[model samples]
Target chain A: MSKNNSRKIKQSVFIILMLTPAIVGFFVFYIYVNFKSVVMAFSFEKGGETFYGLDNFIRFFKEFTLPDTMFKDTILNTLKSFLSTIVIVYPVSLIMCYFIYKKIVGYRFFRCLFYIPAIIMPTVSAVLFKYIISMEGPIDVFLMRFFGRNVPDFLQDGSLAMGTIIFYSVYFSFGGNILYFGGAMNGISQEVIESATLDGCGWVRELISIVIPMIWPTFSTLLLTASVGIFTASGPVLLFTQGGFNTYTISYWIYEQMLENNNLEFASAVGLSCSVIGFPIVMLIKWGLNKIGDKVGA
Target chain B: MKGSKIKRSISQRVVFAVVFVLFCIYAITLIYPYIFAFNAALKESGRVFTRDMVSLAKPARWKNFVDVFGEFVVSDSGYFKMTWNSVWYSFGGTMVKLITVTLSSYVVCKYRFKGRNLIYNTLIFTMVLPIVGSGPAMYKLLSDINFIESPMMIFTFAGGLMDLMLFAYFKSIPWEYAEAAFIDGAGHFKVFYKIMLPQAMPAISVIFIMTVVSCWNDYSAPILYMNEKYPTLASGLYSFHERIRYSHKHPIFFAGALFAILPPLAIFIAFQNSIMDKVFLGGLKG
Candidate 1:
């Protein structure tokens, strides 16, 4: 056999060996499941995967178009939760990261404290917060002692639950992003910043001109990912409130649907229907952000 | 002008100190939950509701820890077994992950194979697509396959994000080392497993730690699919919480939560630098 032919055979064999796990994983985990899901979206779980012929889709739509339907609140709340993090977590983390990056007094201490929550179980964190905010918990205890009156029940009050959930999310979301941004900031050569300092750049000016511009790539990367986070952000609601009190994000709604005695197909259909709306919105936002970032050259 | 500038500078320093103090206060707020848990877990049992949460009792209720572990002993709901299950899941999943990520990534980065970009782009496309309601579908598939209870499900699913990062990391590695290894009569397997894998260790380790931490913390998937028989530490802890919420005292639950959190916390502290810093860099710098 010719040497080149033998080498070609060897290469082909190697490629197959390398690609098998990925191919299998894709088929088993992603493709097959998704294909089945798309089909399941057209069926009813109550009837044991019996064909429903867009009935589920119509039900999903009715959930939005009709008043007192669930789909509207869930999708809206999901976006609201995502936006809350964007408003609170994104900037605060950047600022906190800047402080840590500057190696401010006790920055190391603060960094560890901030990052610890990201590693702990979200459920565990939720439980901690739940205990703290419960009627008999610290928040009430503190308020009753100091102010001679207790605040409204946070977890159970329909009005306060969403805010409480958002607070929990934003609080925990801080450290990981700060670590990411701080790491990116650390990548900026010290000489660049020191030279700016020598040139008498104030903190605000340095942050605006040098830091933001230099870290633009990482910033854009995170921003683009945040667009995808729109659909993904449910904010530990499963553990927090079990998605009750007007707090059911789409993710939680689907989780709740699946847990029902006869809603697996209904859950699959609702998920598919939401994705139809959410997927395009996410993609559009990602594209819009990318264009803006590139045009700004940030 | 000079006097005004000095005055301005002194005021700025004062402002900075005040801001630092305020930040310290804010940081306490961020950390207050854990502190409250620790204090509550140690305080005298009946006083948890009445006493200020921040105060540490003279004789700490260390029996909280004993109660948590001991309660698990009388029942089939084994916290130790669940933790062991979590360890097994992390281990087994990470092993499968190293294969799926490292091998495919090495191939994608190295070989000029047919349809390589197809493989790569397929991954990117799937990632951007919203997987918002993918659970029921995945659950159905797993159930259909009779594989719902096993830990292997967790292993195979670590593909998308980790693979993308691994591909980028592998691409950045210089090809000269592989060439040298090949010249020394090493085959494809040796070049991948020995040469490339070691070089890719830093990036790989970051993903490994991430997978380990995430698997240890996961509650839903195990609870959803694994049923009552083989719950992970997370789901097991969750079930234990629900079971004992009204029955057990607050200290016991707090101790259980603290124990549940400890392993991942240790892992995070150990790898805080690698994860927070190098992970973003490694995962993104493609």
Candidate 2:
């Protein structure tokens, strides 16, 4: 071979060697795992007997329909958590990002403060929050002192536990929103904002008309990603409630099935079922968002 | 027009004031938990339940911090061992991930080759397409392959969002530097290591710290795979808390939790600017 051909061969070898590790990892972890999950969803394993078909998926649907099973509650809680992200966390985070972007008083301080949750371990946050809302913790103590009555344990009470978990999830999520939306807002032109100010556009009006539309790509992407994670809308279930007090989301239920009960096939089925159900909904939302983006020229 | 500008400024100030107060209250919520944890960790274990949580720790037993090292044990691994586990796991995982991601990203982004766009498209496709509920499948695969509880688990982090970030970062750097290195008799490997990699170091370092923080705090993987044999601080502390949930060891547990948090907290404080700026940039560019 010529010297140029030799160099070309060398480059090929280099590329192959460089890409090998990541390719291997992607194939094994991402592709193969997903493939196996689909297979496992169809396979049935019980009492040392192994069979293949839709047995596991059938069992999943049956359990899902059963009134006594926690499946219904898990689905409902998951939806609630998903709604909390979209309705509560997303809008609230966008507004907060706007305020910080506008350089509101103490904005720098608040920016640092808000990003704290993104850095800290979820385990640490959950532990701290757990203690804070425990029976005799500060919230409890405050209620007793101020209202002259003791409060129920937030994490233990079935009626309030899911709400508490959702609250924590919402709280922990803002930091990430700030990072993304803050970055997006940074891309907005200062000239436009100044022009809006001269036109007497107030903060709310400016945020609604200018800042949001400018940052709509980021906003819409985050929103769509949250929708994709609808089935997996989870709090720190293991750390906070351990799937107790009717606070189990679909993700946590799947986790519990696999880890605790050793029901891999069942967990796979439930997961695959959720994916099948969630895919179209996500696609619809994506399409809808894209149309809106086109309409607004975002 | 000048009057309107003044009016806008006045309205903005009013809004700013309201936002500032709300932020102060929100800031209190964020800071208060850590403060409470620190105070509670300093209190006597038994007294933690009896006393008002807002009250300062009477006698301020600093011994809980000292005792936590001994008390926060999982299986045979003590707190120090767990800390060591965390250090190695985080560093090892981050290094493996960054090295692979950096290498792959550099090659794919810088060099034009066959299957390059395919690889790039695959990465993007995998990222955008959310495949839900593969945890069980992942666990099974790892167990079957004897990857569970093995040090090799770090390699699994080799390809992820880091790919997109590093890819974007590498793509932006002009190839003229490589051409210069080539003129000076540098080969492909030397060009990357000597010329290109150094230029990419700032972005890599930011990603390194972020990944290290994430890996340090990751309890789920260790909990599922490493189990009791090799418990990192997060997992060991979690298991410790679970073991002693009913016992009067809240202060000691809190102490361990505080200790577990300090490394990442210190890291964030040190690299706050780079992390905030670069990570945001990476997110957008990627």
Tens digits of lDDT, candidate 1, B1-286: 1232222256557756776786688788777888888877776654444445555655887787776766552137565776777788777877777768777878887888788888878877876777666778877777777777775576556444228788888888898998998899898888888888888899888888888888788877776766467877777767766665455556766777788888888888888878776767656656
Residue range A1-298, candidate 1, lDDT tens digits: 6987987898899989778887888777788778778887887644445666887878777767887876677787898888887787888889888777766677788888878778888767888888778765777878888988876888888888988998888878888888778777877887787788788888778887888877877777777677666766668787877877888888877776666535777677777776777788778877787786677676
For each candidate, give its TM-score against the true structure.
Answer: 0.92, 0.95
Q: State how far residue B171 of model 1 sits from its true place (Å).
A: 2.5
CA RMSD of each candidate after superposition: 3.7, 2.7
**lDDT of candidate 2 over B1-286, digit per residue (tens):** 1232233357567777887898888889999999998988888776445455567888899999999888777889999988988888999999988887888889988988888888888776554455668989988888888888777787778645237767777877889989998888888999999988998887888888888999998988888878567888888877877866466687888898888888888988888888776656654645
Q: Which residue segments of model 1 deviate by more than 4 Å?
A: A45-49, B1-15, B43-59, B73-75, B155-162
**DockQ each:** 0.51, 0.61
The DockQ-based CAPRI class assigned to model 2 is medium
Q: Lowest lDDT 10-mer window, candidate 2 chain B?
A: B1-10
Residue pairs in collision within model 1: none
* Residue A33 Cα positional deviation in candidate 2, in Å, after optimal superposition: 1.3
